[model samples]
Target chain A: MATPVMDKAQATATADYITATFRIRRFNPEESDAVIWEDFQITIDPKERVLDALHKIKWDTDGTLTFRRSCAHGICGSDAMRINGRNRLACKTLIKDINPDKPITVEPIKGLTVLKDLVVDMEPFFQAFRDVMPFLVTEGNEPTRERLQSAEDRERFDDTTKCILCAACTSSCPVFWNDGQYFGPAAIVNAHRFIFDSRDEAGEQRLEILNDKDGVWRCRTTFNCTDACPRGIEVTKAIQEVKRALITRRF
Target chain B: MSTDTSGAIDGVTLYDVDNPAPVIEPPRKRTKKTPKGGGTNFEMIAWLFMRLSGIVLVVLVIGHLLIQLVLDGGVSKIGFAFVAGRWASPWWQTWDLVMLWLAMLHGANGLRTVINDYAERDNTRFWLKMLLYTATVFTILLGTLVIFTFDPNIS
Candidate 1:
């Protein structure tokens, strides 16, 4: 279940409105060659999300302000952007959670080309995801019955399975920001999801794919990915697990 | 206004048929020619070597430091005679040899990863690694030779 925008205790109390300044990095190809910072002042309830603040700015202040957000709750992962110098789902970041007294800086996630104000070219990120062969890869004919797995076996990769592909974890990575060839943390985390699955037969192939120069070895264990994951996935730990698997040649 | 406003911000003139921005390839987009997976476990082995050698290096380095700097009159006793006495034994020679090899390889691999991470261009990365390897090999070989061929009685 989605977490309520405002808890019952807060909802019961008198709503407090505060003026929040959103300093958004604006970019439009038609306007100018250089990117510009555009700040919008909006009075909103502290319990409302950064997404709501953005919506208020777009509707009431300026229609030209561009950003990508869907499912104004956090599930869609489309709203992952750099808020206050950290990757977060705008929908998940509450105005009061971040210091409302200061201006909240919202920019596009790093390591990807910005197509517009806040929309980046997601093709490269998706390509890395595709290269890992994210789906199950069992060989031979399909069985009449479902492939059974114990609950204990299922728990091995449960943390990584929470990934929404928000590009927050991948883009927040320092290595990804510099070396584009290095498969970022998200791809490795996704690979881990299937590699540890009890029923998956292609763990070896996936390990081989990740064993390249641009694979798990590039991770410096900065833990930026773990911090950036809106789903709270332990990204660095999953990467280290993949590295250990490669070393031992075991799942 | 003239039909061609060279660098102006006019809408239609900036992107006409004759004048258009160069289209660049997206970052890290794998092409047909891009090699898929490295068919070898070279990187995996290197990574494993780092951890294993790192553990060994801790013991070797701390022992060396303790003997040379902390034990038996500290830094004052670390003279030519003290060195000669240590090298006279094959055990000390082997210990120094192993320490030299492990520490050099561990450090070289660490630097290599650093270069690979920071150096953006292919030529820059390749040349930086080349320099690192050359220096590492020279130092390791020189240290090994010194350990094996030290004539303690030459003094």
Candidate 2:
């Protein structure tokens, strides 16, 4: 790993800069029917994220090179892409984290149509997210005050609330690659967030929606989502919990 | 995706062409707790059964191999008399019977997952699974018969 950039002096140390090659897959819908991998060499701080290298390419070498990014930090979830054949956020993966010597291969996340270089058609991803009703539902009138919640109640579904809807976990899945109809992992993670919420009254409806063949049943217990999640959500365990809830009829 | 207007031999024509409007069907919703016709989706049960059977098989298969291939004087001590002797006891008969059934079902279920994952064509998948079920049933039935109907007095 690159020496952790602790203080200012180490952060910009000239000696820490190294030359790395970025081999990026380029696709132009307007131009060619085929895609091509273009390579560019650049010198960068080893501690910098892969997004920094893409910025350099876009600014200096090829202005036509395209990608998506807003918050350079990891929280935005806008920069999720395939780096070195794995789904990861471009902003979180450092140059040193993924073999700085070997040409860093950057491509869009799989199982989605590439609208541009790194921009995938996120309609399906968002569609699945919307179908899960990633919101709290209650049958009764609104609570008079800020709805009272104990710490224990808050902790039940806490782990699943970290989902950023990045689609990294979903697109990395082999099952999703095979069948797009399957509600991918991010949708399930979002569902698990609300389903286990002690205050949510509509948990049963969400569970019923997931009980369909293309729903939670298609998961197949693959741990790829757990591995691919940049937010460190226990995706597979959450899926199993949903399955158990379905089998036992207990939300 | 017959979204393009072209003959089999002709190249696809871009949007300057006429094609049928795409069909958009919402995802098929399921209301039944079980699959339609009030039967369980046996595949889900089979998946759960795989793990349970796997644990049992590890014990049954290893213990069987130890007694037959290692514990006695090896394979040399096993012959027709050894076979007849083991089947004479009801316990050994039941052990072999359980082993036979579990191994057959477990292997068949595992192959079913493989077929679901790899078989691309609908007809090919159906026929291949039929063949697998046929062989599995044949072997299981024959093995069950041999275990229960052994003469033991045969030369």
Candidate 3:
């Protein structure tokens, strides 16, 4: 049980600063039939995020390195993209956290049309969101005061309220990719929010809406949407809850 | 942004570029009752069937292989006599009968899921599932009949 001797590690001042390569998928509909990867070499700070590196590349090296972001923090959900083979918020994923040894792969989320380097046409995703009737629906006159709900009732559908409509969960779905008609996970999550809400009178109406051919039945529960969600929502469980609600006629 | 003049969207009046929020639409009403007998819970049952049958199949299939491939000289000991001897016992007969039915149904339903996921056209999906169901039924009937009417004394 003798103590093992440790070798002296090399001392380098630039240890915190590593040279990272970014491989980005580029496509323009009129230009090419397929996508091509463009690589950019950058020296990045360990604490900096992948979004910051993207901004650096776009700002310094290439002006055309296009992507979307609003509140550089994770709240806006505008910066959702594929980073290193997984869907996540670019602003939330640290460059060093993803292993800086190899080239980091950044691309637009799948199951959507890429308008440029990393920006996708979110019209279809939004349309799916819209089709689910995401807003609260009431049958009668508006209440004078706020519609009161119990703490337990509020907790029922609270998990689904984390949806920022990032489209990360929807685009990462195989069913959405194979058959775009399916309402996808985001729509179902939104429906679950209202379907379980105690104050919402139109729960049955929303449930009836979700009872379409492309509605709750189409979700195969592949867990892709659950895995891809940046919000850490239990997407598959919500879908199953909605399904049980459809059968039991109660939430 | 300019009204999507193509009318690709059904209910939206037009696209507003200035306020690009997605236009929310009402959910479509259920056009017809969920067919006649097989009510709305048919898909739910099918999903449940897959999981339940999968768990049972793992036991039945692994036990089947263990006896047929690993017990007392394995496949070499298997022949018409071995099968006839095993079928002689009512327990084995029931075990095999249940296994045949469950396997055929489970495999058929799994392929049905695959076809639903991949088949692009309605006709393609329907016809493919029809072919699968036909094969599964034929195999189940033939296997069940053989298991029941097996003659132990035949040459």
Candidate 2 lDDT over A1-251, as tens digits, reads 78865688775688889999999988665444346689999999889999999998899999989898888888888999999999999999999999989999999998777777788877777877877789889887887888777999999889999988888999898877765666789989899999999888889888877776567777878799999999999999999998888777731
lDDT of 3 at A36: 68
Clashes of each: 0, 0, 0
Candidate 3, residue A245: the lDDT equals 88
lDDT of 3 at A22: 91
Position B146, candidate 1: lDDT: 91
Candidates, ranked, TM-score: 1, 2, 3
Please write out the lDDT profile of model 1 over residues A1-251, one tens digit for every residue: 99767787787665688888999998666544456688888899899999999889989999988888878777889999999999999999999999999999999999888877888888778888989999998889999999999999999999999999999998999888877787899899999999999999999999999998988988889999999999999999999999888877642
Q: List the residue pairs that clash in candidate 1.
A: none
Per-residue lDDT tens digits for candidate 3, residues B58-155, read: 99999999999998999999999999999999999999999999999999988987898788788898999999999999999999999999998887
Worst 10 residues of 2 chain B by lDDT: B23-32
Residue-level lDDT for B14 in candidate 1: 51
Mark the regions of model 1 whose C-alpha exceeds 4 Å error after superposition.
A1-15, B1-33, B153-155
* Candidate 1 residue lDDT tens string, B1-155: 35532334545335334544333233354433457776887888888789889999999999999999998899998888899999989899999999999998999999998988888778988999999999999999999989888887884
Q: lDDT for every model?
A: 0.86, 0.81, 0.81
**What tens digits encode model 2's per-residue C-alpha lDDT throughout B1-155?**
25522222255423222433222222221122213222334545665688799999999999999999999598789988999999999999999999999999999988877776556567888999999999999999999999989989997
Taking the candidates in order, what DockQ does each have? 0.33, 0.11, 0.07
Task: Rate residue B127 of model 1 by lDDT.
Answer: 97
